[model samples]
Target: MLDNNLDTIINKTYIIDKTPLNEEKIKKVIISLKDSIISSKEEITAANAIDIKNHNGNIIDFSIIERIFKNINNEKIYYGNVTTLKKDNNKYYGKQYFDKGNVLIFNTGNPYIILEIFLKNFLAGNTSIIVTTNYAYGLNKLLETIIKTVLETNNLSPDFINLLTTDAPEELLKNNYANIDLVIALGNKSFQNKITNYSKVPVLLSGYETFDLYIDEMLDKTFLTKIINLHLPMHVYINKNLKIDLRGSMLVDGVEEAIMQINYNGNGYSSAIFTSNDDNAANFISKVKSKIVTVNTSPTIERLMDIQVKDLVLEKTVIYPNKKKN
Candidate 1:
């Protein structure tokens, strides 16, 4: 259970996040974050080790963390304006979202996903509040601490990024007047539904997602073992229940079988097919409705979380009305 002061906490933080943001500060914060990760690899890995151990030895997906670093270096990290053309005659108004706003996130089981969202919010100039996934609370707390340390060292406010441990979102959601601008959630169907049912704010739901691998024909055990060792781990991360429980929730043989499995069962976030024939690979990639499509590749978490900073701004654009000289 969380503190009884959830409402007070949100109100206070919402005011802090409203502080004006500049790209120079955002860049410095990102640089500080990267340096902290580089300097704190041992701690981060050890923290993950504890979470994985406590949760029955399920592996922490490294690929996701790698993307956290990569995403920080995205070409648009320094982008400050949308460069929209001002209309003739009327007073032009242009406001950059990243400069001032707040975003709320409901994390799934993956810490990397939360980290990705944090970076996106930071780069876009908005404060982020993360409601940690209940199942991965300990690991998420470590992430919280890491972020705090980085922010403190960079002379940034810890309130710039916030975390809540309670699984009780209903309490906050019940308050219709909560000061929230955007909501993003990544989780299973139940998690998605919970947010949708209560969150009146604009929602970006990364719904219950999994991944599958299909072979052209039943391959030899040796080949199977090699691919599994290399790529099966990705499926583990994609599975809604973490790598331990539902890693293979959607492994099928043919395209038809995979389609039928999902139609009768559920959908995956991504699909990968390894085949000697290009046409077969193309066909498989074409048919699946997963957000990501890949052929002969590990549907790594790094790839799954690849997104631009502009995405946040697209959802909520700040309108600036500059005054012309009197």
Candidate 2:
């Protein structure tokens, strides 16, 4: 079944590459998708409920649903800010950004994060083939419907997003016939490693095996617990029990030690430090090696878009010498 769809999906992306989506149309599609999701909340929840039950009462499924609704509005903010290069000196130099074609997003059991990654690709005008496992069939089906309607209503290609629910995602990953330009895999180290090995194309990874939060000194145990609880559910770094069981939850000697631990052991996706001292926060934020460094605040759902931005598009630098015709 996937083999049959691969050609059509690749062809659709070729059409998009030739005739790119304008900013207005992109905005319209995003708006429609957000509205559709809001209107379909109850149905979405119901669909996710089945996934949860199938996964043996995985409460994380519900959390994914809620996060989607909570963060849907934030998608609008990403529009109108597509960066471009400015002409410099006598050289007509600038950069051009283009959408990657046919991104295969592998769902590692959480529909919400996959959906978030898909929208980032959508915003950048990339066509996506979202491969979901059987556990998330119901939720993904509903999302596929909602997104397709939005795209068609905006007079865009419905093939811009494709959802394939298979028990074995590796089959799709290993398929050489598909014109897959990139693969976005959201999972732990083992899952990411498998996808990386299976994919013929380059793989962009989100989520993490271990994420760290470093503290200079021990605070109230209650306060530390609150910090962990706030960031735990939103991230894959924590386990199902909601305990900060791994490397991220640790006490350090000082800001310097905290910075070193995070830089060495962290996944470079995100890291946070909670401190009232401006000097410590500044030092930590500046020195941390993660893509996102925050002080006195945990990473929020809004930052998810920021972290995944680089993986969504392709960039090229253009340079031309400006010479007067004589």
Candidate 3:
């Protein structure tokens, strides 16, 4: 019933530029986020209630994160060791070394913490540090803290740390190819094409997706509606079906909007779920009990399903409903 183009759906939403907040504002934001999430627990529980699980396969009441963030104080959560590095290039193979400190990486149900630790250790000896991830906002905050810590500890210039941005893996390789000593790559298959057959620096590839089970549970109803709306504009009925469109980015916004809506206690419903195939849809469906109906041909959906599924899951949300039937 919707007549809007994919372009309109994507353009209407803001992807990156959420206003910058100061420390006090940030605290308020966190509080608001926390309150919203906590308030939604009852609705989420009633919507798509499923048994929580852990690595050991035991049924858990709630995600470990709920306790970590919900109950713990911010100051306690931010506590970590401070490392001061005396400027010494000789100690680290002629690269000027700043401070080597340990920072805690929060668990979002992924190995990014491990990756961050590895990179921190790997870069400790070097004079400079560079971090790259699809999470530009998060990367910016992390870099800000690292810069602040380095400047405060060593009393040096603020520009000591450099930040760079690139659109794809090839761009990353092209810009920093031989210059990079250690590179940590996040997200799986999307970067494959961009990283394959390259003689670049060491690349650590983690799983293509990381699921926030808590957020997913909270956004279940919104997700169903958005998925239906997205395909509806194309005259597609995705009820336990798979729909593939080249306009995957458009769907990304819808998913994020769904999450923001649920997380912030807004009326908006968005998630980051989209795919070009059925297998991936099947995987998500199996996990979340949802369906999709697309107008795309079966063969086309099959071709892009896996990569699409992997990419979608990385941002959170399970794949669902593989193929649409005419």
Candidate 4:
């Protein structure tokens, strides 16, 4: 009776741990994610070798590590500091953390063993989507829209989007490439240099570059508060030389708050947008005004707006709004 009970418990644990993800469903997600990553110019690399040093202070050959590296090249090893560790009776059991190229390292007893199991399970169940862009602004809007669509369609958790962004090295790409079903490329000649030649997944060039928003105004507390409430995702690029006194959370939170405040103040709704270039900035602002909301025009805003509308409108024309009787 005792033996039977133990076996049952062991079987139950195995069943719980071994439950797989839906590969077909995950494949769609992975394709979308991969396209976004590629279009964004995010770097993707592969793992090369596994360094094994046993507790006896001797270099040991781990078959699992050998097998893992055998499929990948040596140039793609991710080197990073271990961020977390498991403790067995107060002693170190395993360690995990990000490496130099943002590669995650799990250097416990057998890192490859854990990694293999993880990859196997991840591939077996969930589909991974990779989006590569040159920068955050590259496919920011499109990717954001796609993410929202995915969330609404599948009822997936928003936290899954966080995995789409990482500073990890290319080594991890090898494990990923093995299970990926689709790859989407963005940009024309510029993106050609960004992708690898030997990807096993089916690659599709989606489209040309999309414009991103840019803000050049000095954002004050009041304005920041208004911007925050708008509920728009914007990438803030402060000048490297200009010292802006604001906490990271404050900046992120303030934009949402500011949008709300603007709506309440009856000064029209404001949505914060960001881009790396002036033209893209103008295009984004135009799109927002036409499709999103009536944007407040400042000197900086006026300049960008004018640049965008210059060819469409006659030059040196002044128009004024009619004052209404209260």
Top lDDT: which candidate number? 2
Candidate 1, residues 290-315: lDDT per residue as tens digits? 66766655543325553456667643
Error of 1 at 248 (Å): 5.1
Better model by TM-score: candidate 1 vs candidate 4? 1
Error of 1 at 211 (Å): 2.4
Candidate with the larger TM-score of 1 and 2: 1
Instruction: Determine which window of 10 residues in candidate 4 has minimal summed lDDT.
Output: 303-312
Find the 10 residues in a row with the least total lDDT in model 1.
236-245
RMSD of 1: 5.6
Encode model 4's per-residue lDDT on 165-258: one tens digit a residue: 3332233334443324333333222332234443444443311211112233454547654554432222232332234533332232333333
**lDDT, candidate 2, 1-326, per-residue tens:** 44236666677666763264776777667677877887988898788788777762243345555565456545543222444455655777666667767788876545566567667777677777877666566777778888888888877788887876665677776668557888877654456677888888888876542345665434445766665665343222221223334443454457776677666655666776666678987898888877777664554423453335445777777787877667
Model 2 per-residue lDDT at 141: 75
**What's the ranking of the predictions by lDDT, best on top?**
2, 1, 4, 3
RMSD of 3: 20.9
On TM-score, the leading prediction is 1
Error of 1 at 181 (Å): 1.8
Name the runs in model 2 displaced over 4 angstroms. Answer: 1-20, 56-90, 208-307, 320-326
Where does candidate 2 have its weakest 10-residue lDDT segment?
Answer: 233-242
